[model samples]
Target: MSFSLSTTVVSPEGEQLYTFEYAALVTQTSIALVQVYVELGVIEAIGSMLHPREIARIAQIQRLRQDLGLNLAGAAMVLDMAAEIAQLRAQLKAHQSRPQNELF
Candidate 1:
């Protein structure tokens, strides 16, 4: 992934707001997971993968909710993360199969 800063604006209180844009060659599931997080209000914006502990926590919450016979958003998040992990694993396998010299 690569990112570029566009500009920075300073507030009267001396706070800085930096504007930027980023581009990345990413998998489909990565995008899906981001969308899920956004819908759940877990993040302000769609971005990269959540930490492993975060994933585990979400999964645990989902289980607990199910045990209580309650519906929640955590299960959806877990599915999204699982899909992303599978997609990434596939990409890794594909990359590994290519000749070493072909990688750069």
Candidate 2:
């Protein structure tokens, strides 16, 4: 339940930043659970650490498991389907924003 407050890291793409340890602490989860989520492909990590987004996702999974009594596999499947839906929504938005002539 302890974390280093000053530890900050940038994602590999360098687009996201966060206090890696803080995220894990705030979520009340363990680094080991985070690693498990990575293996489940519910989240991706940078080496042994997790990205900010992945940390948030882990928190979501925790809530899902605690509130809804979902198993780890169910939480993983939900995360996967949610990610797929987000990707599809982004693609649909990009497609809609293009000029009508580009449809050809």
Per model, how many backbone clashes are there?
0, 0
True-structure RMSD, every candidate: 14.1, 2.6
Worst 10-residue lDDT window, candidate 1:
19-28
Worst 10 residues of 2 by lDDT: 15-24
Off by over 4 Å in 1: 1-71
lDDT of 2 by residue, 1-104 (tens): 55566556666677555554665677887666666667877777676666677777888889889999999889878888998999999999999999999999
**Total clashes in model 2, counting residue pairs 3 or more apart in sequence or in different chains:** 0
Steric clash count of candidate 1: 0
Q: Write down the lDDT of every candidate, Cα atoms only.
A: 0.49, 0.75
